[model samples]
Target chain A: MEIKETFGLMARHTDDVIVVCALGMSANEWWQVTGSEDTFYMHGAMGFASSFALGLAVAMPDKQVWIIDGDGSLCMNLGTLLTASGQGPANLKHFVLNNGVYQTVGGVPMTGASRSSYTAIAAGAGVERCYTADSMNALSAVLADIKKPGHCFIDLQVERDDGPILAPPQPFEGPEMKYRFGRAMERRFGIEVFGPEGY
Target chain B: MSNPTVHDQLVAALKRCDVGLAASLPDDWITPTLQRLDREPGIAHIRVAREAEAVAAASGAFFAGARSVAVMGATGLFTCLGELATLNLRHQIPLFMLVSERGSRDDHRIYQEVQGRRIKPVLESLDFPYFRITSTADIEELPHAYEWCRMQKRPVIGFLARKLLKG
Candidate 1:
């Protein structure tokens, strides 16, 4: 599915209890999906999100940690996959928006026309389950099937020609949106984001 | 007031800094300090599975925003160098290490004595700032060193000589 469609589906389905770690996407889209008022974004620190997410996921095991990553960003720290799998988290979902380019920094080709195989790599790390979606329909279908208790990767392969989408540039601080995400999810689904399992 | 002992001072400073996690392999020089740290109520002194695991656990504690210190003999400190380079230097994470020095003793027949002598030089080669604590008075820097490490976003090593901990 297209990036926009995947985001819309996530927004609709996410009860807000899931802490979406948004990184390496177009700035505007990243902010919108995260809707995080005050939080750290990689911004320029592309490869570090997964590392941070790994730490956060293990620390806050009760929270459903979702990582919104790009294929290029994943390639930057692929070793993180081994670390992630080493500490199995049933609640973490890793999403890779693979448009075959570093779309934010001038749409540079990432793999020199060679399709990156992240799903295979994730599966090899013992992620339990993995999926790749190259079209909007396939992306929607995968989102419909996100049952937890394992890690999930949705590689959303969009057209390289998708136009530029600009997000706000203000840096966030603290966990205001983290609280909002919890409140939003709790209001809708009666589940605590930072539950008793982790504080 | 001017002097107590290295064991007393390190234990007191670690309590003041609210250090909740500590791990170490045994050593004669650090043995008394380890014993004192073990009796402290606030600190959770853990006997680590290994020095490498101790470093990894310290990184975990740092991420949780807890003050964690790993204690080891001078010999094991050499072995933990790789972990320091990976988790502290490369990642800019702060880890406080207290390494107990070993002096010339008959038991030095083991490989650890050779490693003990090489600790400071290896740390220098890797550019990790270190301090030598020969007397209880030198222990005053413990808290300050921890604060500096947090502020600087790096690791700090305290090399406690045998005389200091023995007293």
Candidate 2:
């Protein structure tokens, strides 16, 4: 099972409330895998997917929220791991594809990056438990262990490199999507998007 | 007796750094601090929809030649984690984070404590340094923290004690 296949299976299980944010290389693979133009937010701004996922999870507790991230990307926002742990959102699942390098930016080797033990970091951050996988079978088995009413952090150790991949051509939808998102969040969280007066 | 209130000390410390943009989402605890920050004409305080959005906006502001910071609660810090690590850490961008302390074991609410204690450890795991402040006495170090961030080209966080904010 390729990484893309893994995403497809996860997508099938996700409902409308589940929000996905893909960053860096994973974003490149994910936009294609899900073919979900709107389902994922290709945060051109790296390291923010987890944070955004947290917001969506808190706002829509009933929905299953997913984050497709890269090791380099996750390392950049490593603080988020701890933050996410503390939030303890049962419906959120964080999948980090660790290629042992910044695969998106020239595939440069990250110093002691892989040896950094993200699983330990996740567990220490209060994730309860975390899983790591390189092959699809392992991934499916670990993902199966992710029970509901808890957060799952999966660190996927993939090949050090993937061939050339292009970002989605369609520019990310503008403020309109934000408005819709805000409305949906407001409905779920019962808080106005921009407060009582609206922004 | 102190010459300035805790709020005044914070404002002075921020002013000393010549901070331009103060971005945040409103919280009852930090409302007074936000209002005080707004009073400084030298600082432009902008309210963002989300805590992470404020961090991103601050990143943009820094690139555009502005020194900026975002105000948020301890829990809001969790929400802004991606930006704190990515834009701020990966790119070596400096965005000051002023977070309100909450969810300690003694706190009145059970709201976000489950995850609140994890904030410090998260910062540690990320290898980012932060300063925890409890009163006006700590104002003198703001410039040093700001300068170090300038030199290192990364984000530095300042956690304000709950009592200080309550006052």
Best by lDDT: 2
User: What TM-score fits each model?
Assistant: 0.55, 0.54
Error of model 2, residue B111, in angstroms: 33
Each prediction's Cα RMSD? 9.4, 13.5
Please, what are the lDDT tens digits per residue for candidate 2 over residues A1-199? 4556677766665544445555566766766676654454544556666665664554445667778877776776776776666657787788887777766667788778846888888888889668887777887687667645688888887766544335453344433334344455556545543334443
| True-structure lDDT of candidate 1 | 0.63
* Candidate 1 displacement at residue B50 in angstroms: 20
* Candidate achieving the largest TM-score: 1
Give the true-structure RMSD of model 1: 9.4
- The per-candidate count of clashes, in order, stands at 4, 2
Q: Give lDDT tens digits, candidate 1, residues A35-120.
A: 64323344334454555554445544666666777777777667666656666667667887777777766677787437447888
Give the distance in Å from residue A44's predicted Cα in candidate 2 to where it truly belongs.
Answer: 3.4
DockQ for the candidates, in order: 0.09, 0.07
